[model samples]
Target: MAISAQAREILDIAVAASEAKLGINPVALEVTDRMPFTDVFLVVSAESPRQVNAIANEIVDELIKHGHKRAKMEGKDEASWILVDCRDVIVHVMLDEKREFYALERLWADAPEVPIEVTPR
Candidate 1:
């Protein structure tokens, strides 16, 4: 399944928001063919838990500002791995260590990547 235009819209908002907050190594995967729930998976990381939460919150705020409501949120308290389900896009903001451990990119290795064109904030 090709990623929808709305998924790209989410990428535009979420990736820029992530970059604005100094989130590192942001990667967008087109996962629609593999999963029915969402069209994209946006994976990013920060050096610390505080930064992880900051990135997660910023992404959610930015998307909501553009009228996108998150369907669900997880791992906010620990901030080691925060997942924000923004309808068509599910964003994973994690601590650097946790990101490396989970290796989501590798887990979804078959999913083709979608480039994020970033203009921070």
Candidate 2:
């Protein structure tokens, strides 16, 4: 499915935010065809719980700063895996262990990835 321009833009913002927080193994999947509710899924992994929360916060903050409304964030308190629902773009900030265990990329292996160029930090 072709990702909408708005969704792509949001994905870019989320990727940049995640990368800024030193998120690892970032993957952006175009899931509009599979998931009718959202256009994209961006999965990022962090080393620690604190970093997980920080990346989630940064993504939400950056999206809001770009005139996008604040997202509905889940699992922030636990900090192992946080989901930031930015309407068309859903951001997943997970710890290294949880990311390896869950393997969202593998679960949605059929979904085509939205290629993003990450800036070196």
Best by lDDT: 2
Work out how many backbone clashes candidate 1 has.
Answer: 0
Residue-level lDDT of model 2, residues 1-121, one tens digit each, is 6899999889999998998889998999989989989999999999999999999999999999999998999998899999999989999999999999999999999999989998765
Each candidate's TM vs. the true structure?
Answer: 0.93, 0.96
TM-score of 1: 0.93
**Candidate 1 ranges beyond 4 A from true positions:** 119-121
RMSD, one per candidate, in order: 1.9, 0.9
| The candidate that achieves the highest TM-score relative to the unseen native structure | 2
Q: For candidate 1, give the lDDT.
A: 0.88
